[model samples]
Each structure stands twice: as structure tokens, then as C-alpha cells.
Target: MCSILHIIGGVMNIAEIGQKVAQQRVALGISQERLAKLSDLSRSTIHHLEHGTLHEIGAAKLFKLLSLLDIQLKTESEVTKPHALEMASRSASVSYKTTISPQELEESLITGKIEPRTISHLATLIDELPLSLIVLVVKEISQRHKIPPKKIWSHIYSWANQFKSPRLAWQ
Candidate 1:
């Protein structure tokens, strides 16, 4: 849920929000030290955001950081679905005939810019990847559950976070 725009309300300078988020992190028992290491975000970015000093933090970086701290800016419950599914009466046949764009993956990391749903979307793509890299993921899950690879992958598909991928969280 959108947190009611509660930005230390009123005209403020840089780093104010950063300070607030940082304070929140501390309250949650996450120190700047650990957050930096785990999130790969600088202590200064944390510092700057809290103080509102970050001149221009792209949406992607902002969400990623907030996600790491367990802060979700927007809530999907407030949004409506596309309604396209209702028109679908027949099963769709998809073929893994396209090459995956490694650049799409790299851009998020390099630019720190991402869309709201991008992370969760990518999580599905990663889990669905049929190439060799993902084969072992199914194999391992199958071994642990004593199920066939197809069944294990089916379970994984069903259990994937529907609202959003774990984002860079589990990376």
C-alpha cells in the first residue's frame, strides 16, 4: 500500500527521506553496516536518501533499496488487472524459440533503474529459463522432494511469488 506520501511532510531538503528510511532500518534491527554489505548500496546512499541529498535516485534503485529493507512503495492490491485473461478461452502454445536478452538483465544492475514489476517478472523468467543453467535448479529441487523433475518444476512454477519476484533479494 502506498504509505500516504508521508515524507517528513512539508518542504524539506535532501536526505530527509533517506534519514527516515535509515531510521526505519535501524528500528527493524538492520544497521547501515549490514545493509550496505547485503544490498551493495553504499552507506552514503543510505545516508543521502535519509537526508534527501540524493539529487536523482532512479525509480529502480529506490525500489530495490526499499525492497531490501522490506519497504514496498506501491501495493498491488490497489491496482486492477489487465482483464485480458477473460478473453482467453483457448490454451496458449508458447515455444522457447527466442534468445534471452542478457543485456536486459545487465541493464538493471548497471543503471540501477527498473520498473515496479520488473524484479518479480524477472524472477519468473529466471526460474523458467530452460537452458542448461536452469536444469540443475529443477534437478536439485527434484532430488530434495523425491519427485520427478517435471513435477518439481511444476511445483516451483506454482509457488513463485505472484505479486512480485523476490527481486534482487534472493540474488
Candidate 2:
């Protein structure tokens, strides 16, 4: 289980904090566009922050982003001595498998059997993967769910389009 932490009192650096934020976001399978919408920040701002190029983030926005990522930035005095430097743990609870059987995956998707709450997990699992891999998965999904691959592809495309440039809210 990967987790992100930010120690505010003695270890607060803008660049490091940005990296931590990016780590948390990716671990959550969240895209920058989604993070921006949830935090009310611009995609460029999210990009800059992830790349550690943004400085002087406002407190409200910072809080919003951290809260959305399930991150905790704590002061030194709030914690005990030995663990005083540690921020609260926000673990990526989803356990992702490297290879899910097509039938199982199809059934999971059709029956809403995924552990994570969002359907974006399907996109995340497929993103940057090979075409053969995608085809195999899609074939199973189509066969089990009785939906054509063309339709599934359309939905995936629409979701990708939305993710590429997310609007003001979760769609």
C-alpha cells in the first residue's frame, strides 16, 4: 500500500510537497484534470505543482488539494516526539492486479464488483497498455456484458476525452 505524507513544520518545501501531491494523485488513479476540478484549480496549475515548478500556492487551495488527495499536512506540535515529523498516513487502499482474467474483469465491471468506487479504474488499468492487452480485456467485457466492443470503445473514448479536459465537476 503506497501512501503520501507531508511534514509541515520542519520539512515543508514547495518542491517536495508538490512531488508528494503528485504521488498521492497517481496512487489514487486520479488525473490532473480531475484533481483540478475537485480542487477548483487550473490544469496548468496542477501540472506546475506536479512538476515542482509552482510556488506560493494559497492556503485555501493547498488545503483543498491536499484534502482531495487524502493527504495530511501537520504541524510539529500536533504529533509526538518520535513520530512528530510524520504526517497522517493516507494509503492507496486499492490493490491492483497486474493481470486480471478477462472473464473475471468482465464480470466485475458488469456486476459492479470492483473494490474502488470509480469506473476510472478501468481507464487507469488500460492507459499506456498495449493494444493486444486492451483487445483481450475488451473482448471479454463485450462477451460477458453483451455490449459490442465498438460501444465500449466509444464509452472509453468519451471518458478519455472528458478526462483530457475535465469540466467543473465529476461527470
**lDDT of candidate model 2 versus the reference:** 0.60
Error of 2 at 38 (Å): 1.1
Q: Each candidate's TM vs. the true structure?
A: 0.34, 0.41
Worst 10 residues of 2 by lDDT: 84-93
Give the Cα lDDT of each candidate: 0.48, 0.60
lDDT of 2 by residue, 88-164 (tens): 00011134434344443455444544534444445454344434344555555666567777876665456556456
Q: What lDDT score is found at residue 51 in candidate 1? A: 65
Alpha-carbon deviation at 162 in model 2, angstroms: 61
Best by lDDT: 2
